[model samples]
Target: MASFVIEGGHRLQGEIHPQGAKNEALQILCAVLLTPEKVTISNIPNIIDVNKLIFILGELGVKVHKIDESTYTFQADDIDLDYLESEKFKKDGSSLRGSIMIVGPLLARFGRGYIPRPGGDKIGRRRLDTHFEGFISLGAKFRYNKEERFYGVEAEQLHGTDMLLDEASVTGTANIIMAAVLAKGTTRIYNAACEPYIQQLSKMINSMGGNISGVGSNLLIIEGVESLGGCEHRVLPDMIEIGSWIGMAAMTKSELTIKDVSWNDLGQIPRVFQKLGINLERKGDDIYIPSQEEYEVQNYIDGSILTVADAPWPGFTPDLLSIVLVIATQAKGSVLIHQKMFESRLFFVDKLIDMGAKVILCDPHRATIIGLNHQSNLKATTMVSPDIRAGISLLIAALSAEGTSTIHNIEQIDRGYQNIVERLQAVGAKIKRVD
Candidate 1:
């Protein structure tokens, strides 16, 4: 396994451009199976998760070619759906939570799909019931084998219907959209997930001749077509990465500028960071973060200690809650970090507490952080990453610490971040990837 050795207390001051959205790119890549023509995706992040999905696509007999460093051309004209049932395919496919996305497109285009249990952060119990429910509503029959932990779906005809998901799960909405894009009738999905990722998938489907409306909203209407032709689309900028950079710049008291951020796509993230006393100055497509000694953590609307929580789209992303929690430890005032999405995400507070930050873990989901206020410097130590976001948050914390820090389980970080150490090094961060 590889680890990151970060020499802390170095200010990072340079321009950084985030890669394409990892979350968005995963679903879009799977959607390529809906067409036989070449589906060209630009600005795609070259990350571990994306690469893993490409490997899975290749195993399924899809011809995937890299056009450039950040562009990919996928042609599934000769896709062999039988490979999806292979044990190696199931094993490799189960390594990512995004593998479930292939079910919809596979079932839509081939009338049957098989998937093993998908893997990701053990943050919380994310159920696939919503996704299966949507598939059943679209006329798919499902069978689950507990011994193998595999899910199978088959249907003669996937006719669209009016369906309402119990939870606006991101992958659930994506699965249904991919399935419905080639179904026979109109499908109305109310309470759908409208995250930028889902909207990007919808745009890609529309470009391929699927009729989709009400993108970026809770309600989605899809008019099924006989088939979809391949079209080219670019992945959107990673807002979460941009947000992570914002938190990193604030924590290290560095003057940094983030380039090419889609200003219009950032929903309430800037305001949420402002509540933590971090200010962002927008100059066209760039976001400027000036160096600051300290930021005051404000109270909530009720005048009590402020509690920042995560919700679905139109809300702060759950992925950034860990970053915010780490940043709050350096703020001037106290605040509550509410991680409603994941039960075990707050467990890392014990590591931060060992570094001398005053934190009270209320439970598995909440932590109260009392800032160090630039008066204290965290003593460097060795730690292990538990998940992708937690790993990056630990990296940011390590960079802001007083001495050198070693973070193990860097594979967790690489799963989502593309060439993270290389990118950070370019911006003056003294980090080395060691095995």
Candidate 2:
């Protein structure tokens, strides 16, 4: 296993760009299987999860061409559907949560999809009920093998139907939309996830000759097409990574520039950081954050403690809540970090507390942070990265702490962040990866 050795209290300054979104890449990559034509995708982040999916696609006999580190053209003209039932796929597919996405396109075009229970983060109970339920509504037969812990869905030909999602799961919506795009009849999906990632996938599907309407909204209507062709698409910059940089700049008191951020697409991200008194200005496509000695959290007009919670799309992303919690440890006022989505994500707060940050773990979903206000610097210590978001948040804490810090289980970080050590090093951060 590799770990990060950080010499703390190093002020970093330089321009940084957020890599292509990990969530978006997973959905878009899986969509290539919907058409036999060549689908070109650029700005694909070279991370562990995305790479794993691309490799799985190749193993399934999708013709893959690597244009550059960030671009790929995939032609699924010849697919080995039998690979889904092979032992090799069970082992490989079980390692990545994104592998579940392969099911939608496979079942749509080939009539059957099989996958082992997928794995990714241990955040909480990320159930697949929504995804399978959507498939079932679309006339697919579902089966589970208890001994093997495998899930399979099959249908001779899908006929679309109207359904309302129990939850606005982003991946669920993507999977359902992908499957619905090829169904025989019209599909009306109410209460769908309208995240930028979903909208991007919808746009790509439309560009490929599918008919989809009511994009960027909770209700989506898809008139199924017999087939889809290939098209070119580019992923948007990762907003969560950009938000993480904002917290990093504030915690380390560093002046930084984040280039090519899709400013308008960053709903509530900038405002949420601004609420922490972190001053950032949008200079064209770049965001400039100046060095600040102190920042105070904002309270409601009624003089109540500010509570930051996660919600569905058009709301603050749950992925950045961990970053918000860590940076709050140094703000002048107290704030409640409500992680409504995942139960165990707040478990990393114990590590932050060990680093000398004042935090109260209310429960699995809530924490109260009393900012140290720069009058006190966090004491550095060794910790372990629990998940992708928690790992980055801890890295920010380590960089702002007074002494050298060590973070174990850094592979969790690499699962989502693309060349994180290299990027941080370029921006003057004293970080290095070691075995």
Candidate 3:
């Protein structure tokens, strides 16, 4: 295990580039299995989860070649179908949540897919029913082995049909889209997730000879093709990382410029930070955040306290709520953060409270933060990170605290952010990764 030892009260300054979108990379990487042609991808983030998925592909007999530091070409021409039933696959597939996505493409190409019980952040109940139901709706047989705790889907041939998802689950939608693109006839999906990641996946599939429409909406149309071909695709910048940097700048009173953030695809992220009274300037495609002594929260027009909640795309992302909640600790006013998607994500507020911030955990999903207004700095303390988003949020808090802080279990942060210590060090942050 590794930990980050951070000395507080240092102002970070300079320009930092956001890595490629982690979510999009997961879906796009798995999409390579839909075709035997060579698919080249650029701007792939060098992170643990992504690297694990790429390694899993190699274990499945996919040819993976490194073109450069952030580029790779994948060819799934000779897949090892028998490996899916191996004990090694069960251990590997259970390591990351993204491994579940391989099932869709495998089923489409080889008529069968198998995966062990997937594992990921323990934020809330992340169910796989939506994924299996979508596959079953497409004429696939779904089976679960209770003793082994494994899921398998098989079909002689998949024929497209109309599917109205119970919820617009992002991974669920991506899995179904991959399966539908190779089915016979047409498939229409309603209440589908339309996040930029999903839109990019659809675009990448189209580039590879698949037909899909309604790129940025809840309704999607896919006309199954006989096969897919190779294509090159580039991932968008990571919005979650952008939001985290914005929060870090505000908390530490730093001047930082996040470079080449896909402004068109950020949805409600910028405005959400603005609601917390963070100053942001858009210089072309970049976001420049000026150093701040303090930022105040804005109340509602009707005289109610401001409430920041997470919803589907076009709304505030749940991933950024942790950063928002942490930044709110230093703001001049109070705000309510509602994490509707995951019930237990707000429990980290207890740690912030221990650091002298006023926070009331209303429940598992809601937290009311009364900003300290910089009257006193947060006192440094030792703590453990529960998950990726929460870990980064705590690191931001530590950077703005009065004394040095040690955060254990920083592997969660590394799973999402690439070279975090090195990146922050270049921008004047006094942080080190200790093993």
lDDT of each: 0.91, 0.96, 0.95
User: Lowest lDDT 10-mer window, candidate 2?
Assistant: 105-114
Q: Rank the candidates by lDDT, best first.
A: 2, 3, 1
Could you tally the backbone clashes for each prediction?
Answer: 0, 0, 0
Question: Which residue segments of model 1 deviate by more than 4 Å?
Answer: none
Clashing pairs in 2: none
Candidate 2 lDDT over residue span 1-435, tens digit each: 999999989889999999999999999999999999999999999999999999999999999999999999999999998899899999999999999999999989999888999999999999999999999999999999999999999999999999999999999999999999999999999999999999999999999999999999999999999999999999999999999999999999999999999998899999999999999999998999999999999999999999999999999999999999999999999999999999999999999999899999999999999999988899999999999999999999999999899999999999999889999999899999999
lDDT, candidate 3, equals: 0.95
Which model is ahead, 1 or 3, in terms of lDDT? 3
**Pairs of colliding residues, candidate 3:** none
In model 1, which range of ten residues has the least summed lDDT?
348-357
Question: What is candidate 2's TM-score against the reference?
Answer: 0.99
| lDDT per residue as tens, model 1, 47-123 | 89889899999989889898899988999999887788788977998998899999999889989988999999878
The regions of model 2 sitting more than 4 angstroms off are none
